[model samples]
Target: MIRHIIAAIATLLALWAMVFMYQLDQKAERFRQIQEIIEKSKQEVPVQKTTQPIQQIEESSVEEQMKKEEDEVAKKLKALRERAGSAMAFKVSPLYKQKCSSCHGVNGEGAIGPSLIGKSEADLYKALTDFKSGVRKNYVMYGLLAKMSDADLKALSEEIATFEEKLKAAAE
Candidate 1:
């Protein structure tokens, strides 16, 4: 009976050892496969190459194209500034200075012409339009407004009508 029991225990131990050995071998094989994959990936990764002659030529052409674009943009901006700079400045008083200030006073305080300081925007716009259309006639004003567009007239009126506010701001 003792001999049978011992033999049974030995057999069980042998089976467990065999299973452990097989599992270890499987794990070692898995580790070997992972190492191979790592080595392959390292070889597959691309390295940055030195620029070739053709690439260098292409880069120079691209740079020239960019420079041409920049120059064109600059020219366009200069043309724009030349075209509408006065209007864009939002100070139509310069126009007044050129055409109306000698008569109207520098601040619309009334020189030879009537004071424009406290005029409403609507009134000023109507007056300017009336002047332009010859409904209100002054030879000098008529000539000054003859070629002015309605938009310019409107802008001028808006600026002139705000003179009181400008005066108050200056005082403060």
Candidate 2:
């Protein structure tokens, strides 16, 4: 019968269409898997942008950052500086500990480098300025003082000059 033959033909077409669509879907899936594999091979695992830590440097102003850098306190210190004024201002500073303690010892007594104790503020300042300006070219000192500001140089000089007093206190 023609009716039965037509029904058989329609069923065959439906089944073939479904098989074709399934093969296409599977091929698409394989391509996606291969892309992921390639990314993995390149060590570029995809991460959400929001998952990274936010850096404040891009947002903050240079002046704001400088003011925020260290705690500024009004304290008196004594030093025989070239330009000695009535008040020698001092603050609780971590710059020496952060920068010089590794080579000069924590107390400036002595270590990998010579003792910095009892050095005059003028001497310290000149030596540091020379090192920073490359007038005195020890690769290590040059590197250490290279990035220092004038304010930083003066502050460090003051702090290191007071090490003699700190030594006296420790002895007591």
Candidate 3:
């Protein structure tokens, strides 16, 4: 009975090996066919006839093409400048910069934290106090404001309240 079991296990392993080899062969055959197709495509591409006389490119068309390229570059540069300008558009107090800028963006435009711009100073102060006093549930905000004084929080709120006006001025 043991001999029969051992023989059966050996037969199953041999069958599995055969199936794996067959699958591998199929994949290898497909790879070879794909390589052949790629080689044929490369060889079949029509080579431009060098025997034909080269026509002189028009100077006006060349100049026009160069102008179009320059315009595209200038447009891309302008877009990049706009993005950079918005990222650090207005200045904030050093206290806010140190405590809030990492999450709340340099201009209070919001990064990880919600936008503080356009908020009333009272609303801002309330939210900051809530975070500090454990009224709000955010661990990150609570941790950040924990060590800070009420005066600092009030100062930050006042500075944040003016972000919208500063952004408007920057836009102008």
Candidate 4:
């Protein structure tokens, strides 16, 4: 009975060893195949050809294109500035200068008030109107802007919008 038990244990150990060796061989074969593929790919050389120069546009055509672009840009800028000026001069600038400038500064750059220079006309108008109507409650500005006429408000808005343009043109 002792001899039979010893034989059985030996047989099991041999089987496990065979299985482990087979798995290692399989992994080695896979690695070898990968290396071969890499070596073969590296040996191949790509063909190179002389590239043709890109065609250039005629001088006149180029000039015309540039002119067209300039005109389009100018038109777009003018339209944008006009709209901005109209809104500033009409709705917000005067009110801001009168009521808020002592605090915010003349251009909304902020002194005692927050900067108004870049604030949109619509935003300024809405805030002022809200304050006047009690939709917004600022103790100081509310009372001040409330007394301003609609026409005055509009002119202020327009003026604020155009002020930057005037400054830029002057600088140039």
Cα TM-score per model: 0.45, 0.46, 0.59, 0.38
Global lDDT scores for all candidate models? 0.64, 0.60, 0.68, 0.52
- Local lDDT at 157 for model 2: 93
Model 2 Cα lDDT, one tens digit per residue, 72-135: 3111111222112211122225687556755565557555568998999999999999989979
Worst 10 residues of 2 by lDDT: 73-82
Model 4 misses residue 94 by how many Å?
7.8
Residue pairs whose backbone atoms clash in candidate 2? none
Candidate achieving the largest lDDT: 3
What tens-digit string does per-residue lDDT give for candidate 3 at 1-172? 9755765664455445445434533454555465467456653233333443442244445556877976886675566555444654655677776677666666787765678889999999999999899898666676668899999989888888999999999889
lDDT (Cα, tens digit) per residue for candidate 1, span 1-172: 9755765664455445445434533454555465567456643333343479887777677767877976886675556544422222223355666555555555576655788989998999898889889899655566667799998888888889888887677556
Q: Where in model 2 is the C-alpha error above 4 Å?
A: 1-92
Task: Give residue 12's lDDT in candidate 1 (0 to 100).
Answer: 55
**Ranking of predictions according to TM-score:** 3, 2, 1, 4
Clashes of 3: 0
Clashing pairs in 3: none
Q: What tens digits encode model 4's per-residue C-alpha lDDT throughout 56-167?
A: 3354456578779768866755565453332222223434444554454334445444555655677766666776776975545544566777666666665555556544
